[model samples]
Target: MSGIIALLDDVAAIAKVASASVDDVVGQAVKASGKAAGAVIDDAAVTPKYLQGFSAKRELPIVWKIARGSLFNKLVILLPVALLLATFAPFVIPILLMIGGAYLCFEGAEKVWHKINPSDHHSEELVSEKLSAAQLEEKKVKGAVKTDFILSAEIMTIVLNALPQDVSIWMTGASLAVAGIIITIVVYGAVALIVKADDVGLHMAAEGNSGFVQSLGRGIVRGMPTVMLLLVVIGTAAMIWVGGNIIVHALNELGWHLPYDVIHDLAVGAAASVPESLAGAVEWGVTAFLDGIIGLVLGLALIPVVTKLIVPLSSWLFPEKQATPH
Candidate 1:
């Protein structure tokens, strides 16, 4: 009897420790995930565009496919890379972040440029060319997955950087896994909701037995366009702000601290000019504004370089076959 009780106590102690570790992992993961909000928001916002022109019945399936790809990107690819970087090439993290940040800046600037110079945009004449629905779906999924890889890389790095240095490798890996799964669920779940909102509204509008229900449904259908536009605007701003902040911080880490220092001082000055109670908000706003400005400038500079150099190099290296119209 005494021996059995002792063994039971030992098992209980082990269980308690395991429970505590699980709690710690969850807490840390949530906190670290918050640091990557910009990337997360942009990820969610950008995904819906891929579903455009697809039939209502197929929207959920496409979202599911992309979500699955996103999970694979975070878990199988980025998680291992992040762990290896954390363990061995810790110094490389900042460089990778800057690269991702540069990409984000380039993307945001391109969007702005295309919007301003709509005539300069690539002719989508090829879009109307005949392609089986299956082929088009495959093409879009592949493109979404490719885009997710960059955004996922950014998110993982941010989470890894936010973790405590003293934490064990196992803890880092476990926490990252948790964060990735949670974020994937949240982001794709939201995408699912956003994509299906119109269908649900249309159904209610068409089949609802009451006038009020029909009006509400119509309202949702009408409101979605504005909501989508707002999401795009917010996502673009976030990409610029986050990208610029990452680049500025990376430069500081790499010993080019002048931009960082200048931005800090400017934010502080702005904060000082405001009331003490509102100082923090003012500082953050000023900092983000300056960061966004930096991102815009850097992005604009890279625009010509990318169009003239990077795009040409990419096309040369991996020339895409132009599909002939049947």
Candidate 2:
């Protein structure tokens, strides 16, 4: 009787510990996931274009395919790399993060530059002209997956960096895995919804028995363009703010605290002058704006390097024109 009671007690104790660990893992995952929201938003905002020009029946299938690719990117590729970095190359995380931030800055700056001096949008049109429907679909999926890999890499790295310093290797891995799964699901699920919404609206408007349903369909069709534009604006803002914040934080970590300190103090002072109810909003807006400015400048600087050096190297390595058969 005594032995059985002791065994039960041990089991209960073990179960309690396991339960606590699960809670911690989930809590940390959620918090870490939140840290990558800027990237997450950008992912959601940018992905629907991959489905553009596809038939209504094909849109959901395309999104589903891309979502699976995103999962593979995060889970099979980036997650393992992230874990290895957390375990062996811990010191490299900050550097990689700074690089990623610079990339974000570059992308955001390009958007701003293009907006200010509007370039003809030719890629999609050209692709549409050159590729068959199947070929175009494949190309879009490949492009989306490639883009997702970059974003996933950044998200995983940020999540790894956000974890507690004393965390065990297994815990770090678990938290990151959960965060990656959750983020992938959230981003692509939202993307699926965004891509299919117009189709849903069209079906309802044309086939529905009710006039209100038809009107709603018309509204969705009209609203899609605006929604896509809003997404672009939001994505650009997020990239700049998040990128600048990462660089600023990296600077502080590297013992150059001046930029961060100045920004923090300025935000505090600005908040103090605002009404109590609006102080928090004012602080966040001001901070984000300043960060965006920094990101824009850094991005603009990188643009020349990318265009003159990186682009040429890539083109050289992967020439669009194939060699003729001997």
Candidate 3:
């Protein structure tokens, strides 16, 4: 009858609205993920190191445990905190972003400094020597999860900052949840593959059916070290670039436009010289390059402050307990 037809139309309209909302959530989630690329990459790059000394059998389980902790960090702890901030004290967001950005720059710069002036510190190894296998695994997992909390906080904050200011709380929550799950899966999934690659290669080298397969396996085993090094380098560069970009943008938001203006002009000038087809790419590259330079300089300046003042103060305030070797 006519009543039934009207109800059908109403249901169809509701479905349309629901579908549009879902699409919006997904779109925002993807965009937010892109904004946190530096942290995500660093997470992936750093996680494999925790697996370095563990037997192959324990690697995947440890990765799984860490991944679960990362998820809890983002979803349970950070997501709520981010939402509360956006709701009650939105002004604090940019300050937090700057702090996180500065941290990224400091970490990236420290890596560069260490590379230039390598020093052997076997503190972890020394500690590990004292613990049983199970205890060592527990300790490493705890350390990794603790590190993940910092990175996860940065990722969540970046995602929240990337969202539109007018979005509803529900929309914001959905976007963050989606972004967190996507990033966690991607970072840990990649870590799993990276850690397992060597074992796979070794297995192939030993047990492959044919010479060609065995040779390919051998190549993989030989190539993994170079791949790990490349990943670390890439991660470091990403941290510096993203950190610098965040700082400059934060400064611009806070009404100091000098750095922003200078960088924009430089990018524009660089783009002008390139072919029209390559103009956009050239501009982005130039901007990223400048941002990285700023980050490196800032990071280098912070190193001595962090080492001389911050580290000493922290150690004094919360000195670590020395464990006697069993």
Taken over the whole model, the C-alpha lDDT of each candidate is 0.88, 0.83, 0.88
CA displacement after TM-score superposition, residue 322 of candidate 3 (Å): 6.8
TM-scores for every predicted model: 0.90, 0.85, 0.84
Per-residue C-alpha lDDT of model 3 across residues 258-318, encoded as one tens digit per residue: 9999999999999999899999999999999999999999999999999899878977786
How big is the positional error of residue 127 in model 3, measured in Å on the Cα after superposition? 5.3
- Give the least accurate 10-residue stretch of model 1, judged by summed lDDT: 317-326
Report the CA-based lDDT of candidate 3 relative to the real structure: 0.88
Candidate 2 lDDT score relative to the true structure? 0.83
On a 0 to 1 TM-score scale, where does candidate 1 land against the true structure? 0.90
What C-alpha root-mean-square deviation, in Å, does candidate 3 show against the real structure? Answer: 3.3
Clashing pairs in 3: none
- Locate the minimum summed-lDDT window of 10 residues in model 2: 317-326
How does candidate 2 fare on TM-score?
0.85
lDDT of 1 by residue, 208-247 (tens): 9999999999999999888878777877777788789889
Sort the candidates on lDDT, descending order. Answer: 1, 3, 2
Highest-scoring model, TM-score: 1
Q: Which candidate leads in lDDT?
A: 1
Evaluation by TM-score, superior candidate among 1 and 3: 1
Tell me each candidate's RMSD, in Å, in order. Answer: 2.6, 3.4, 3.3
